[model samples]
Target: MSTVPKRFEILLVSEHVEDRGGASVEDSAVRSAVVEATGRHGASGYPIYEGHGIVADIDPETRTVEALLVDGRELDYGLTALVRTAARG
Candidate 1:
């Protein structure tokens, strides 16, 4: 028997500080977002990983729906609430 890979959602928030002028600019922007999100949300003690400015919250024991946040804006309240609740404990 084969098992399916678990899916999880990641919230991405980032800012462009300077015009690096190239793909490096994009890379830096993403890195900054990941660092910030991890610093803020990682405190929740949830399994958080930072890559390309994406902060992922994952629980192997639980299923998580996808959510995306760009520039610190939340597009879905339901997903936000779920994340908040999970973060609290």
Candidate 2:
């Protein structure tokens, strides 16, 4: 059986559109959405999303994300979807 990680990492790769002169608007919007989805302070020096038994640590400057499974014993479909959306953006 495949085991899900208690903690996982996500790398945010932004696509810079030359025509737009910088990062795509969609990318910016997605990042903002991710930030807005989170609550609480940054004890780890970065904003984190902790809810529904999941904790997401996001660092926009470094373009990295760390996802930790808290109360959940497994990564459910909803959690997987959330991560996929963030990673794709």
Candidate 3:
């Protein structure tokens, strides 16, 4: 058995996701959703997503997600609330 963290909600303010793709995701825009695999979530300090500024590169891992920007930044935060807000608006 593997020790993986439970699936959590996050803000995927990018165009690409792990498995599913949708219309809500736009260029440089932020979309709220829930992800399972750890690679989909990155550590703290990285900017979640910018409005067509830095290149959002997401590196997926087994138990963690590493995100890098064109300027070399990171995004780490619990995006549950953001997702809820974005979906409503």
Q: Highest lDDT, which number? A: 2
Model 2 TM: 0.31
Q: How close is candidate 1 to the true structure, as a TM-score?
A: 0.27
What is each predicted model's overall lDDT from 0 to 1? 0.35, 0.41, 0.36
Summarize candidate 3's per-residue lDDT along 1-89 as a digit string, tens digits: 64433343344453346643454443334543443333433355322432332333232222223443433444434321122212322
Candidate 2 lDDT tens digits, 2-61: 322222233223343346457544543322233234544355665665544545665545
- Per-model TM-score versus the true fold: 0.27, 0.31, 0.23
Alpha carbon lDDT of residue 36, candidate 2?
32
Total clashing residue pairs per candidate? 1, 0, 5
Backbone clashes in model 3, listed as residue pairs: 13-30, 39-61, 46-74, 46-75, 47-74
Ranking of models by lDDT: 2, 3, 1
Task: State residue 62's C-alpha deviation in candidate 1, in Å.
Answer: 1.1
Could you tell me which 10 consecutive residues in candidate 2 have the lowest summed lDDT? 3-12
Q: How much is 33 displaced in model 2, in angstroms?
A: 14
| Cα misplacement distance, residue 44 of candidate 2 (Å) | 1.3
